[model samples]
Target: MSTKLHSAVEVGHLRKVRRLLTADGANLVNAGDGLAEETPLHLAARLGKADIAEILLDSGADPQLRCRCPFVNKFDMNNGRGDALHIAAAFGHASVIEVLLAACEPQAPDADGYFRLLDLTAMYGHVEALNLLLERCPMDVSVRSQALCFALEHAQIECARALISSGVDVTTPRRLYRPDGKGIRPLQFALSPYSDPCDDHILKTEEEALELVKLLVEAGADVNANATIAHRFGRYDGCDEVSILSCAAHYKLLKAANFLLASGADLNAKDEKGWTALHVAVASGNPENVRLFLDAGASHQVTWNICTVLDNDNYKFTKKWTALDVIGMCDTRILDLRVSLDWKKYTLIGDYTEVIELLVEDGADIEAKHETRYVGNTLLHSACSIANLSAPAGFKRSEFENGIICMNTTIQRLLPTVAAFVKAGANPNCLNRFHETPLHVLLSGVMNAIETVSGSYKYHHAYNWVEEEEKPSIQLLFQCICRTVRVLASAGADLN
Candidate 1:
């Protein structure tokens, strides 16, 4: 009898449904079918047969009755059970949803009930259903957050896009927690998604994703809003409490970075750690991203600013860092630049070759004095300091080899930068606060390496090189260093 009633409703046979719902079939109005164990009303709602739905509702259909069908969801957030309203929204049955809401009239769903409908609608990407729910159902900011995040995480771009123009703040994260104990966010995920879209079988094309971002900003998503959650996919580097713009730069999402800057994201807005978007771009070693930030009017001298950091032994000190300083600091790890110097203090390293070129081209403060933590170190001094800080004056076959390659490339670049600085009426021989000149710093490093080579200076690590392979590599490395010093000498450094 129940099977016949459900078939009648599924076929939209009003007369058959009415005939079955007579005194004999009245009890069958809420009977579960053998297939899905869903009541006749659930079938009507799922099929969007409003006429049939109204009959079921008028007879004895329970709008709040749950079906025992297993849900085919990836996350299983909704435990495989749904009511008529849930079934209607999941399939975008706007007309049938109206009937279900009418059936439940005079008793609007409580907060939890309203969101169940909204969540189901959003989860399935039914814009019409979502629109109707957003209209008839009242949602606070928290509800809006949950709805938007659910839409985003499920890759339901249309539903997520529709929710934006409905006055929901796009900057908010979902109230629901993921396995990581962190809530998913719209902008944060757009910048750095936790999983590939294909991992969930939701193919969100790049163009489609960009369109969603456009809708977000068009609806007043804060371009400078600090991310509620920092979802990182690559190397974990830098502080986590980063703004969206900084995160874009860190991930080298050039399109995102470009769009954010075009949308008027604050280029110099400092993150909690006081690193600007450009600072992150420089650290990420993406020359194009670095160029993007600078073209968007990132402060050429912002990296020259000092940030507070702790030193070894827990002493506090202020360090002046620059894009010039952070270049050549990447290896092995992903976008991570803050290398641990034996876990005492933090220093940045990345292969920022083209980034360095862009900075130089942007008229960076080549003669800037506040380039490093040491007092009054000029750009030249800090350039040498980075070489010393990373490689040090060591005499190991491999360490010395890596150190020379790094230092040689850096000073070689700085040599031309020095000429440009001198042409701009800046002094290459400018004295640091220690009264030591840039040339003095370079010479000290060369002397240390030479002394360590002759076994005069204290050095560790045995040279595991065969004599034949050692001599030529060492000679070539010195040639690279010599060529750089020769350029500095020609650039009017006080050779005396």
Candidate 2:
């Protein structure tokens, strides 16, 4: 008989519930449902059926009757087992929440020992429901912290603001309700790029997110809070204690970055890996952010440059690399800057030409050489190597065979980049540790290409005409090579 009443209340059949309650000796108001062991009132509140919930309450339903369900360990399901108020709050049932709170102690936590109604409502982004509960009961310090952390993690702006206004410590590091067991403060979550949960919708625009950040800052949130989460789950290496400014620069949150900068964030703050916001900006290929950092007077100091003296021999000084050296080696093909790989693979290619120009214009050592096992190549050498290895585009074999040499294509594509270095006074004859110049790097790449193509014909004796067919392609390749070599030579390269 109680089972029938439970079913009626679950589907919001108010008349059926009233009928069952009026039956002879039917005591079913607080009877636990077969599944999840939720009482009839729990079912009504969970489904946001205010009429059914009110009827259950009127018929002596225990509003504080806890659900006998296992708690899900995920952030969204952190407090799986709860009472009528918890259920109503989790589902954003404002009317049902008011009914449940009237019959129950509002500040009581749920059965799982994790969430109060405030925490549950904030986690699920139930602003109205949360407001209803807050009006009746005061949130304690611990509960306020938990609610605000959940609110920030889920991007629940209004719920977060309410918690903040109620004096929740924004800088307090609460244990994140994930399997990894790391503690993250509210400000760190706000700075995170992956804060948006799959279930809840909050902070739709950059402007909205920035406003929330301002609110947190105004509420005494730490702008320099360190991120304790590991980066192993993603492409970037997770550091032990990365600052919020580094996170902003890494994720390219321009407005947030500017705001943090304006708020007196430590511009020179280094993470556990010894990276500042400038390193992160350059590494992430965000030239705009890099420019911002530079414009804000971010130090261009690197580890190697710091150790070496300016009065040291030019050759010895060139051995130490800097951010400019890292930019020179950025791979043009890969779009994602956060991918884990060799630091030398962090170049921006042709896309961020303005950034490269900016770095040079702002006094980055244009002729800075990278110390490697094979060579100590400068930025100019790196540029030449990239151009030499890049595949020729839009070249037909017949055009080469017809003696149509398109030097303009080479000039238009890559020569200007080399010219930028030369115009900035790059030493065309500058030798690496192996005594090889930029011309030597270009020649080696060209030779390798020619040798690879020539070896293909060596095994083909029947196709004598194949040599003729190969002539145009080889000529075209050599044409680009010669034009580049000519540009370097004209720029005062050592021919010998």
Candidate 3:
């Protein structure tokens, strides 16, 4: 057995190596090839040859022999500090894993100081093999495994279920948030049961994911639980920062949204920003959600300004919506009351029909105008003003110049509202304090840009940093000229 046994074992010719060892029926345990620790059992275990392993064990080979100075001793590789169990586990041979676990002494530390059986099994997704190790090995199940994390990341549901059932606290806190803190919990990872939407990784099917979500929710996991713990752990994404209900709202999951709401989730709860659930629904442009929130008593007047909540934020935004200026057609007292009551929390549902009916029932003065202080422009004016037109004077010239907001492109900004007002009988030709009509007020001057504090541009919290030109509203002037031309043409007024 000069070197024939060692070379045959090296090449995995286990039967040949064993034959050479037992040629004279020598005890496999004591059979060594010149090397200090080159035992026949070591060869079989090193190569993960279960057949050879069984043969050597039956032939009186000592299973617990430590191979001292038998192989490469590269200092870089932790001084070659590995054993037969390490080799077998690394190769993922169930039979070899079983043999090593059985032959090793009870609580005997592997050369690495811990036998990570589940870890190895999770890594390879060897379910059957893991089951064997779980049954036979006295390994600690509490050790955090890269394999477990990988299984979750890849969404191997079967493997994850097994690990979870085997006493893995899914919400174990891990340190990822503060520098010296205990860490974040595990349930956070369960927040988004799907893989990266931007990536093409098919982590889980929709049905499978829904089932998982249902199971997690049923198992005392808060369906509306704040998943910010994951965000604290650096999983920075939309899903990580919101509760399940918020996520459903963001993704337009109507059923999920309703379920969360019915389950007593706070609809008015603000997120990291001061945005309530109703705010999100409107910003999402989903009319269904718009109606849902309104019916659920969500405030329509609250607006987000610079990510901060705004009071009395009234605006009905639709492709063909009559702007809030229509509220001017409503009773001033009612408007005052709505402003005072923080009506931003309520949204207009179903054409504001209910709102209109309620106002009618309250005997509201529908024709009341903000002629002096509030500048009551009507619904039609608001609508056309959004198209960049001006409100008609509807008063005398001096009053138009002072009260009509003719300067600073006020007329242009109020164009849609002006048109809405005309459509609602605010009088397109109503004289201002000056003798100029609505069309006359529009033709006053050219426009640059206006300075505004809490209007449409700033309502959504956008920053408009461009410097304003001192010029007046030219668009209004152009509209006025066009209107004059159209009037002269239509009324048979002769051009000089």
Tell me the spans in candidate 1 whose CA falls farther than 4 Å from its real position.
1-27, 33-37, 68-79, 105-115, 135-206, 230-240, 250-253, 282-287, 299-496
Candidate 2 has its poorest 10 consecutive residues by lDDT at 399-408
Please provide TM-scores, in order, for all candidate models, with all chains considered together: 0.54, 0.63, 0.40
Tens digits of per-residue lDDT, candidate 3, 1-496, equal 5356556656778668668767844643556665445566666655667776776566666665555422222123333333555445445567776766666643343454543545545544557666665566545544533334444544555655666666555544444334544342333333233333333334544444444444444444555455442321133331223444544444444555665577676777655444555544543334455456566766544433221122346543322111122332211211111111111212221133333333333333334332222334333222223222222221112221221222333333243334333433344444434443444434332231222212322332232332233123344445644653464334343333
RMSD of 2: 12.5
Q: Considering summed lDDT, which 10 consecutive residues are worst modelled in model 1?
A: 338-347
Task: Give the winner by lDDT.
Answer: 2
TM for candidate 2 is: 0.63
Better of 1 and 3 by lDDT: 1
lDDT of candidates 1 onward, in order: 0.59, 0.64, 0.43
Clashes of each: 5, 3, 53
lDDT for each residue of candidate 2 in 261-310, tens digit (9 for 90 to 100): 99989888776546677877865657788889999998665632222223
Q: How many backbone clashes does candidate 2 have?
A: 3
Task: Quote the lDDT for 310 in model 2.
Answer: 35
The candidate with the higher lDDT, 2 or 3, is 2
